[model samples]
Target: MKQRSEQSQGTVYGFLAYLLWGAFPLYFAALKPATAFEVLCHRILWTLVVCLIALAATKQLRFLRDLARDPRRLGTMAVAGVLIAINWVVYIFAVVTGHTVEAALGYFLNPLVTVALGVIVLREKLRPLQWVAVGVGVIACVYLAIDYGRPPLISITLALTFAAYGLMKKRIGGSANALQSLAAESAVLAPVAVVILAVITARGETTFTTQGVGHTLLLLSTGIATAVPLLLFAAAASRVPLVTIGLLQFITPVLQLLCGVLVLGEHMNLARWIGFAIVWVALAILTVDSLQATTRARRLARAAQGAAC
Candidate 1:
C-alpha cells in the first residue's frame, strides 16, 4: 500500500514536471529579442542563485562543501554542465527560429538514443519489443530526412547533446545529490555567463540593459523556469520506477509538438506528420513493452515470496 501510494504521488509529480517542461518553448519564446546566448547566461546565473537559496533554506548546504572536497566529481559535473548548456542553447535556438517542430522531433528521438547508449555502453539487454521499437524509430528518422530533403540537424544535434548529457550524469553515479550536481554545473558555467553579461553590457548590447521591464523580468525568470521542473523530476524519480518515469517523459516533446503546430503556427507538411506518427507508434510500442516487463517482474517477485512462505 505504501508502494502504491508512492507510485501515485510519483505520477502526480512526474505529470507536473513534464507538463512544466513541455511548456518551456512558450516560456523561452516570451524572452525573445534576447539572444539565445544572453538568455542562456541569465538562466545559468539565476538557476545557480535559486538553487543556492533552496539549499540554504533546506539546510542542505553541506552538499556543496562535500562536493568541494571532491575535485574529480566536480570535473565530471563540469563536463555534464557543458553538455546541458549546449542542449539548452540549441533548444532555445530551435524555439526562437521557429523550428520548434524539429526540436520536438529531437526530444521524440531522445528515448531511443538513450536506449541505444545503454545497450552500447552498459551492455544492457533489450527486450525483443524494444529492438522493434528502436527499428521503427530509425525508420521514422529516415522518413523525416527524406521529407526534409536533408538531415534534420536541429533534431539530431539536440538528441545527441541531450543523450550525451544523460550519459555523463549516469556515469557520475551518486557522487553528488541532485541539487549539488546542478549547483556544481551552474557554478562551472557561471563565470562564463558573467563574462558574457559583462561583455554585452560593456557594448550596450545586453538585452537586460536595453529591454523594457517586462522583458527583463522574463529574462530573469529563466532561472525559475529552468529549476522548477528539474526539482519536480527529482522528486518523482525518487518515488517511481525508472520505467514509469520513462513513460511520463514523452509528455514534454508531445506538448512541444502541439505548441509548434497550433500555437506557433509552423508549417507541418503531410510527410512530416506521417513521420511523427511513425515515431509516436514506436514510442507506444516501447512504452507497452516497458509496462509488460515491469508487470512480469512484479508477478515473479510475488510468486517467489509466496513460494518461500
Candidate 2:
C-alpha cells in the first residue's frame, strides 16, 4: 500500500510537470511583436525578482552568502546558468517563430544527449540496453539531418545545451535549493540583460514599450512559467525515483510534436514519421528496462524490510 501511494504520487507529479512544460509554447508564441531576445531579457529580469522573493520568504539568505564564497559548485552552477539561459532563449525563439516541431525534436533528443553526457562528464556506465537506445536516437538524428540537407541546428543546440545543463545540475547535487540556484543563475545573466535593454532603449529600438501592456506581462509570465515548473520538478524529484521521472520527460516533447503538427501546422513528412518511430522504439526499450529494473529493486527492498521485521 505504501509503495502504491508513492507510485501514485510520482505519477501525479510527473503528469503535472509534463503538463506545465507541454503548454509552454502557447505562452511564448503569444508574444508576437517582441523578438525572442527581448522576451528573454524580461524573463531573466523577472525570474530574478521572483527568486529574490523566494529567498526572502524562505530565509535562505545565508545560502546565498555562502554561495559567493564557495567557488567550486558556484562556478559549476554559473556554467549551468549560461547553458540553460541559452537554451531557454533558443526554445522561445523556436516556438515563437513556428518551429515548435523542431523545439519538440530538441527536447526529444535531450534525454539521449543527457545520457551521453553522463558517460562523458560523470564517467557513468550505461547498461547494454541504454547503449542501444542511444544508438537508435543517434541514427534517427542522422537520418533527419540527411533529409533536411543541413543539420537541425535549432534542435541540436537546444538538446546539447540542455543536456549539458542537466549534467551540471546533477554535479551540483542537493547542495543548493532550487530557488537559490535559480537566483544565482539569474544573477549571472541579469547584468547582461540590463546592458542590452539599456542599449536597445537608448537607440529607440525597444520592442517592449510599443508592444502594448498586454504582451509585456505575458512575457513576464515566462519567468514564472520557467521557475514554478523547476520548483515542481524539484518537489517531484525529491519524492520520486529517477526512473519514474525519466518516463515523465516524454510528455512535453510528445505534446510539442502534436502542437506542431496540428496547431502550428508544421509539415510532417514520411521522413519525419520514420524518424519519430525510431525515437519511439528507443524510448520503449529504455522504458521497459527501467520498469524491469524498478521492479527488481522494489522486490529486493521489500525482502530486506521483511527480514528486518
Candidate 3:
C-alpha cells in the first residue's frame, strides 16, 4: 500500500514535470527579440543562481565541496554541461525560428537514440523487439529526410546531444543529487555565460533592460522554468519504477507536437504525418517490449521468493 501510494505520487510529479517541459515552446516563443544566444546565456546564469540558492536553503552546499574534490566526476559533469548547453540553445533556436515541430520530432526520437547509444557505447545487446523498433525508427528518419529534401538536422542534433548527456549523467552515477548535479552543470557553464553576456552588453544589443518590465520578468523567470520540472522529475524518479518513468517520457513530445500544430500553426503535410506515425508505431513497440520484460523480471523474482519460502 505504501509502495502504491508512492507510485501514485510519483506519477503526479512525473505528469507535472512533463507538462511544464511540453509547454516550453510557448514560454520560449514569448521571449522573442532576445535572440536564442542571449536567452541561453541568461538561462545558464540564472539557473546557476537559482540552484545555488536552493542548495544553500536546503543545507546541501557541502555537495559542491565534495564534487570539486572529485576531479573525474567534475570533468564528466563538465562534458554533460556542454552537451546540455548545446541541447538548450538548439531547442531555443528551433522555437524562435518556428521549427518547433521539428524540435518535437527530436524529442520523440530521443528514446531510440538512447537505445542505439547503449548498444554502441555500452556494448549492450538489444532484444528482437527492441531491434525492430530501432529499425523502424531508422525508416522513419529516412522518410523524413526524403520528405524534407534533406536530413532533419535539428531533430537529429537534439536527440544525439541529449542522449550523450544522459550517458554522461549515468557515468556520474548517484554521487550527486539532482539539485547538486544541475548546480554543477550550471557552474561549469556559468563562465561562458558570463562572457557571452558581457559581450552582448558591451555591444548594447542586449534585450534584458530595454525589453519592458514584463519581458524582463519573463527572462528572469527562465531559471525557475528550467529548475522546477527537473526537481519534479527527480522526485518522481526516486519513487517510481524505471519502466513507469520511461513510459511517461512520451508526454513531453506529444504535447510539443500539439503546441506546434495547434498553437504555433506549423504546417504538416501528409508525408510528415506518415513519418511521425511510423515513429509512433516504433515507440509503441518499444513500450510493449519494455513492459513485457519488466513483468517477466517481476515474475521471476516472485517465483524465487516462493521457492525459498
Which candidate ranks first by TM-score, i.e. highest? 3
TM-score for each candidate, following the candidate numbering: 0.95, 0.93, 0.99
In terms of lDDT, the best-performing candidate is 3
Cα lDDT, model 3, residue 268:
95
Judge candidate 3 at residue 197 and give its lDDT.
Answer: 92
Ranking by lDDT: 3, 1, 2
Tens digits of per-residue lDDT, candidate 2, 1-309, equal 897787677678778878889988877778886778788888899999888888989888788788889998789878988998899889989988888988999998888888888898889999898899899998989988988788889999999999988888878878887888899899888899999888878988777768788876786676787788888887787777888799888999999888888877889999888887887888788788788878999999999999999
Clashing residue pairs, backbone N/CA/C < 3 A, model 1: none
Score each candidate by Cα lDDT: 0.90, 0.85, 0.96
Residue-level lDDT of model 1, residues 138-183, one tens digit each, is: 9999999999999998998899889989999998987667787788
How well is each residue in 126-185 modelled by candidate 3, as lDDT tens digits? Answer: 999999999999999999999999999999999999999999999988888899999999
Per-residue lDDT of 36 in model 1: 85
Ranking by TM-score: 3, 1, 2
Comparing candidate 2 with candidate 3, which one achieves the higher lDDT? 3
